[model samples]
Target: MIEILSPARIERARDAGRLVGTILRTLARRTQVGTNLLEIDAWARRMIEDAGAQSCYVDYAPAFGRGPFGHWICTAVNDAVLHGKPHDLRLSSGDLLTLDLAVSLRGVAADAAISLIVGEARDAQDERMIATTEQALAAGIATAGPGARVGDLSHAIGTVLAGAGYPINLEFGGHGIGSSMHQDPHIANTGRPGRGYRLRPGMMLALEPWVMADTDQLVTDPDGWTLRSATGARAAHSEQTILITEDGAEILTLPNP
Candidate 1:
């Protein structure tokens, strides 16, 4: 369902957003070569508990996934992109990693994701893919504001990724996020501008732009959750929860500089 959060609710969302950002940053810093995927999940659990917050993913069960997620964070490495279930795997140098997280605090929720190289730079293409996703995310956020249509943001994001020579996948994209991790007003990564739901003040949305290096097709892993590139090409994903305000869109998940 679409939700226009009240001012007090927005404040609660901000708190959740900050926590999500901080946790992702902390995990990125702690992650390195030989780091186990399970270790990252464990760290996220501790942090969420210490903050007296809740993990949106731990017990998440959706039709697309295999039962409960049973993980505190999503650790997608290399070919893996979205809904990557944590497994018994250790990261190695040059591995491309993506960490997506969501947390609820004070009855509000925020979601965000980041992609980076695990230890050392392996291929220049990997860096380019990551940069493209980041750029697309910024473009999408820039298009969000009062009276703006969801398609406008999607078009902005798609233009960036397509221009960067990456194929866009529509199977899964951003969505409305607030009291729950995922909500209504499905935000596709690419669409025609001046279409879809119109933006309004107090609306919160999670805009994510993800792409595979070579193709738009995706193949699900045996785990029934992780989505990988059909061609085994490297992929990158970037996302942020934004609040629509009178002035413009305020990115709630930005890391403190």
Candidate 2:
């Protein structure tokens, strides 16, 4: 399931990537204290429909999750990290929130995620958690390019998280993405260099670096989808969809003006 985009297909990918980036930015702006999680999902639904794009998560039913995600975006808050299913909770000041989104436009899909504090209060620990993930993501992207190994990207990501004193979780990480949301060549957050799949031009990869404050263990919420830290410590995650090119890796999902 490793998809390599043709020249024309790359254009469609960019379109989808832009849509994802714009939608995320819009959602981030709208989020604040007292905003309900469900409200955010509804907003995402409207924006995706207006753009004539499809949500990769709305109808998603994977083995690890309950049937049909039935949500437009993943609203992970505080201790919650991955596969966060939006619920009735209202955001409060100082809440660390992560929004992960993916959409298909013109048959190509792009995925990305961002973590930030909800309001004016920026806890030092929360800021460190978010910064570490962002730094790890940047490092991963910097190591990506034609002929580079997946391990190289993983090592780059691991160095940042480890240096920041955060435990790395391998249960979920980045992966190949294209026509469908998740694809082959699983990219772990930490690994040895010069190992795993080799990079090639026209290939697309979603490089995500996520970490929990205290432990690497995760617990599934009662909803059967949201993954939270076992120790209930704050967490953060960062992601972007990148396209492998002959020259280097091109980040497709960046916020639009």
Leading candidate by lDDT:
2
lDDT (Cα) of model 2: 0.94
Backbone clash total, candidate 1: 0
TM-score of each: 0.98, 0.99
The true-versus-predicted C-alpha distance at residue 168 of model 1, in Å, is 0.9
Whole-model lDDT, model 1: 0.93
Where is the poorest 10-residue window by lDDT in model 1? 248-257
lDDT over C-alpha atoms for residue 39 of model 2: 97
lDDT of 1 at 211: 92
The segments of candidate 1 whose C-alpha lies over 4 angstroms from its true place after superposition are none
Q: Candidate 1 at 88: error in angstroms?
A: 1.1
